[model samples]
Target: MAALTKDSMFERHIEDVEKDIVSVTSGETRPAAGIDSEVANFFASQSQGPIEIDEATDRRLRWMIHKRVLLVMVVTYFAQTLDKGTINFASIMGIVEDTHLVGQQYSWLTTCVYLAILAWEFPTNRLIQRLPIGKYLSFNIAAWGAVLACTAACKNFTGLIIVRTLLGIFECVCQPAFVFLSTMWYRREEQALVIGAFYSMNGFQQCVGGLIAYGVAQIEGQVLKNWQILFTMLGCITFVWGIFVGFWLPDSPIRATCFSPEDRLLMAERVRKNETGIQNKEFKWYQVREALSDPVVWSVTLISFTNGMPTGGLGAFSNLIIKAFGFTTLQTYLLAIAQGAIIMTFLFSAAYLSKRYNQKLLLAIIYTLPNIIGTVVFLTVPTRSDTKVGLLISFYLTMAFGAVSVLNLAVMSNNVAGRTKQVVASSLVFIAWAVGNAVGPQVFRANDAPRYIKAFIAHMVVYALQVVVLFFLRLYLMRLNVLKRRAAALRESTANGEDRDEHLAHNHAFDDLTDRENPDFRYTY
Candidate 1:
């Protein structure tokens, strides 16, 4: 069946009927007009049982869905991160000389990838909404893998830039799509762990890349550079994996192929309390405006931007920094594995703590502390033989700041409710992320060389600001939740006295109301 459009009578009836449905669902007396004819009818016709199914069924179905989702997410994310991490490995393996990169050209190679991502973020998100997400993502993954493989043939800055730019364009859908998919399949509480589980692949790849790159670098083929070999090998693996995605991955719970008919219904029913309606393809302009005007949306965008700087910086240059510490190329790769360990430790721990404590905002703020301290110590600690260990430790600590970014992403996905608003909000956050990454590499000027004191100082300022934005964002959400609870209370009292308005009794579940407009909606902080 086609989805209801804005002009549908069902859509028109949503506003009036929403309160009735909320009241009925909350166990209040039925409205006098009889919700049986409209809102209740919609539910009864669509499913076999109540929207809230039995607890055992809900739990069993959640585990099944989570198992499938995490498997796909972890593998795909690991592949994506591994491909991206190749540049850092390549830098150590003589990409500069082979590509004939001149002053700041290597930096541009890194920057342009993100530049492409920033440029394509909005359009790609819109496409994700319009198309089948699983297929769209699979196609892009394959395309990027091919592009990454082509990078092996590029012998100059222009060639490298072209391939890298295409890689960026192809990969741009990844973060937003994963976040959106997580929201689609998981409840708000489960989303943080799902996102953490998948995104922690960044750390896993770092750990794996060290071992892989170390091995791949030993291949001394007369026809290709080790960097080229690295690109070709990972790219081919991803291309094959993309095919797997197309065959197996589901776009959303409703479209899931692995579940039984009853299980799929349970999946849909499970997330109604999320208050964020499931997938809606038709774009609503008002939701876009609402997302733009929301202060918390902007706060999350700022956090994405600021936190992305260190990511861009470290992703492109962490190995070089280790190399500068007088380690051989092989040794630098091994030492960088420690950075990955640190990153995984922080990300997994923060995600677990956020899940355990139910405090994403608190964890986000707390996680930034390490990066702030790391940057300060990296700058203040003298560059001596003995202090080199401290410098490396500080570098590892910078990765702890990255966990704040993971938590920030969870916060965005958790708080945004309407489908259109979530899409727009996701794109905006990642666009800021892309911009920060683009800017990050440019700051690590060739003149800065080994110490890069200026870059460290810049990171210090951004991370400090990140903590402030997180606090404000939390307070804003708390205030909104309070207001919503009060409003719902008022509606409940008024609902008890009034005769049911027929127009109001026809509320549709999929009307796609923004959280602010949906009185039943509450922000999860």
Candidate 2:
């Protein structure tokens, strides 16, 4: 080449090096946008070797954090379940006998709590974002514990109603706050297992609460009834736990002191990598709008609403259903313990499947299928002595969906990207849950006892509907994933092309500059 220019020589050298690099790198390929090379160069200049740390030491640190966080969440949720379930326990202890409430009025007690939860959910969730989560959550836990204790002092339907309303308001903060706290600590892949551990307590509480009630029911000298003693004991335990939370719970990875500086940095980077970005410094209105406009949000909400109706009915009246089997109070309490154990087993299995397969919607539908079958058996099976065991077992079997509820929460959190949108979506989902709870209890009128035919039929219908909703929701999610992949491919192709004018038009049409501005942004699946 006559008098080779420096540019021509450099170009020839680059081409030769590229061929050598491609040969040695095997199948490795670069991103069309040049982002992969850019990131590789940045990391290459930062260090001469890979980072090192003691694996065993890191393991111990993670274990400590996991234990502390799990304990706090389990105790908090246990207190909530105890407060809500005390009414069911109390019903068996003759509170209904003393209060003289009739017909649908008893159902109103359950309804009122849910209504209050619905009214306060969104505002309380937003408050969690604005405040220090650990402190705010602890205060709420303490307040609700005090309210639970006060339930022991109620003398009539009105007193019970007032106490339940207040309890609902305070307890509204627990679930959302706990979810937010857990998210701050873990990546999405690890989230389901931790969430499952905490959520398993919903089943465990039935066992623990039943045992406590059995012991309290034996108390003969108290001025108040034994059921009142049950409430007071649970409340005191919860209050103490709240005090412990204030000292033990850390705000976030950035602020936590339980780990070394390196561990903290690792935790932060791990989360950032999974989320495709660091924690947002400020909320964005556009992100909120995008989340609200998502079709999956509504689909997820409807599935929860339908699934919750049967869940609420069962949770609120499982004791009454057990009592219908003609067992003594002590026997009923023992059976409740067994039921709780079975539910726990089922919950754990479902949680494992959810984590291992990343198949939440499918797992939810599978869980609902059993309940639908149980409801049908309970409704249609003859009430003869021979069929009694089937009915009782079916009643206990329906509670297996406890894991599905946990999965639903995890799904919603993972699927909503922005902080504020996650909060809003959570609030909306729980509001649907509250509304379902409000409607569920009304199906089990006092007159429908022994068979509760109407309640059984209602549950069947609702559960079947839930299965349908989950099927369609899964399809919707699959289609959305396909569309997102296609869009990403098209963007990559445009970025790699040579047509400046066409690329500019395409970029303007697709708002491609937004992606460049925030390169780390990712759509939640």
Candidate 3:
């Protein structure tokens, strides 16, 4: 009789806990009580026999994921960057004379791509949410590859703008896809390193791009200008590469064909601890509101804007600046290889240290400090041959901002939750990026030419301002974490001896809840 009574009490307690966790009222799920049926079903399905992922299995999975996914990401980013950066190389290869570009028309060439991005980002983001990401990205890549090929044939400013606009529309898919896909496959701890490795492709692309352009520059007496030959060759290569992305890349873990059904389940279960759901098709208006209202999103967007000014200025005119320092055209291209190396070193190091030390936000601030020093030197140093070496060193150090950029992207990815909200936040950040890049080139007029003292001063001010913003963003996230922890504590205290399930308390990691709605969703700094 005593044993029966105790068993009845235990069963009753379990039922009460489940009731608290799985509650729904009037077709709407309350954040505090339980997750939606979709999330609850996913957890029940994946939790077959204790979700134990062994170390060896984890290593194997990571290796496969990198081989399958990371390879595509790096190659796609490299091609996109190489194609976009060709304009800088082309400037030295005689595009200025060939196209009859006058005054700010050359600057407008760079601005057109970003302007297109700004115009299309939100609509593209909506498409990303609704469509199969892998297929969508692959199609866009192939489409852009064709546009890039067409760029080789552009004869005038209008022709260039038309193609560059198409390039921007197609290329906008890359970053957001990578961000969402990283969240899909990896844990929060692993995301930074993976994102860093992929984003670092920009640096590698710079190196290879310089080499390719240098090779093209050696050609003479051909029907086409060397710049045209360079574009045509790179565009053809990218077009072929796009086919590979379409066929090989998997969209999400659940949809991945490389793994078995059992392995796929494990893959989905693996990221359940991320407290951000894998994929949610429904676009909730409240989540969109939450994202726009969040201070972190706006702060990150502002940071992107400020940082992008220098990025755009340097990217568009770095070769011109270096040539102004008295290096020959070929010499400028070769020296750019060195700049790429510096970028690669800093970006990889920052990501590694952040992963090793768990200081994502701190490393972002630290990386920007070098850019401040670099800009100050550039502003003060006379544009004379005697001081060229100092200016070159400053230029090299300024590439440290590359690290800051990678960290910022990782920070945004790490903090935001909910598929719709993440998409919205990413769109806004990239929109800011577009605006910054567009504004950056306008600062460097034909009149400013070689030294561009005004441009460097702008960079210096923005770098310093960026540091301040990062500090405040960190403080804001920490405050949110503290508040959430307190709420969690209070909720636990009132449990009345009901057993608290770890997964239940986590509110189902795949539950389509905004970060604000899920009390268990703590902000990662």
Candidate 4:
């Protein structure tokens, strides 16, 4: 933002300096989207100031958004989860035996998807920023669905890798899009639950997808293998759903047809408190530079990597791990239902804690406690028939990491600002996620199968480091908040009358400033 003189800081009105703020928004296209374009489109306008909305109206508007917006996000994420999980579910159904995936070949099948995601993250995020999100995402989803269907035709490891890589490239758009949506449609305070509700589909899909996989396995046909049937069924369903979402979902609040022009303004007003600008087509290199150097971005990147390691391992290997305990293939699928329930429970608890408390990063640490205990048991326990159930419970406890991942999404979204900066930070964290996931499956080598002792030991160290990173992330945010408050105090001491109103105004909210540039932006974690 523009540097103000001491006399201008508290003595002059912000409206007077509207003529003088080219310094503040030098590279930015000011008031991008909902605050500016929508106001122009609607004919009924709101001059930028404090948008006083009553509690009941705000509550009603939020639910109205939840019904249309949140539902679309949840279903889209659920489809993406189920589609990505085809290989995981297929593992127990004989894809390995059919494709002759000996040694670490199976692990590579899982590893390649994330490798594709890692390669596509930066380029894909740039597209997400520049294109119409709903249409672009729907096209990708539809394309991935067709690619996933081709997994049914793969006769060997190389063919499957080609399709799975395509699957990863297309599905990579879902996550960053959802994170951006949470910021666009909701206030900062409302983001946690919205993110949790959609992301919890990671678990929910396990419940539904497991049942679907089991039934498909029972199909009797030599013309198509059970795994082939499963892949084709999942891919076709996703393709149909993706086409539907293109028509049903809106690109942005400014573009949402479900709400009236007046309601759109209300929707715009609802999220203005977030200080993070809604949408800006202009890509500022400085903000990208800011995200690269920003401690908050790197802190979350490390946290995301440590968390992603175990998550990716489990994503591909959970059923295989269960099967190693001597359970039949069908039994393993049935047992994963219980694991899904455990994940759902942990996710909801984390969401509740985030909504009720202000300590988001601390809650991420606390949620990891169970996973740590779980890892200890997984590492030390004997893998006897009598100890099977105990080991399985330990597996479930490790699912508490899901809570940490979802909570981190809310924290990162809450903290980052500026369009390019948010995209850069999000892409960096997901790239770390892909790297962690790619490395994750490599640890579960075929040599260490039945009971991957070394992998569990590695998990213990990684999970511990995850907690330490989260703690330091919390401290860094708290320190940043302190500095912001110190600056606010100095600015406040000289303020009076219209100066107070000018200082308090959210006029800078849509100015496309990075979090550091916006004086009013507060760190939540």
Best by lDDT: 4
Candidate 2 at residue 222, lDDT?
70
Clashes of each: 2, 0, 0, 0
Q: Indicate the residue-level lDDT of 463 in model 3.
A: 82
Angstrom error of the Cα, residue 196, model 4: value is 0.7
TM-score (C-alpha, index-matched) for candidate 4: 0.90
Task: List TM-score per model, in order.
Answer: 0.88, 0.82, 0.90, 0.90
The lDDT per prediction is 0.80, 0.69, 0.81, 0.83
**Candidate 4 — which residues are off by over 4 angstroms?**
1-48, 490-503
By summed lDDT, the worst window of 10 consecutive residues in model 1 runs over: 30-39
Worst 10 residues of 3 by lDDT: 491-500
CA deviation > 4 Å runs, candidate 2: 1-58, 276-283, 490-525
Q: After superposition, how far is residue 15 of candidate 3 from its true place, in Å?
A: 34
- Candidate 1: pairs in clash: 16-504, 17-504
Could you give the C-alpha RMSD of every candidate to the true structure, in order shown? 8.4, 12.4, 9.5, 6.7
Cα-lDDT of candidate 4: 0.83
Residue range 157-176, candidate 3, lDDT tens digits: 89999998999999988888
- The residue-by-residue lDDT of candidate 2 on 1-525, one tens digit each, is 555786597457445433433332342322221222322343344443333335685566567667767678877787788778888888888788777777777788888898999999988988886666778788888888888899888878899899889888988887887777666666676677777877777778789878888888888987888777788888887788787788888766656777666665555444442332223333456545545665566767776687678777778788878877777779889888888888788778877887788678788888877787777778778776677778888887788678778777777766555465666677888889888888888888788886789988887777778778777667655544333333334332332221223221111111111121222222232
User: Which pairs of residues have clashing backbones in candidate 2?
Assistant: none
Candidate 3 Cα outliers beyond 4 Å, as residue runs = 1-50, 490-507
Ranking by lDDT: 4, 3, 1, 2
Report the candidate with higher lDDT, 3 versus 4.
Answer: 4
Candidate 3 versus the native: TM-score? Answer: 0.90
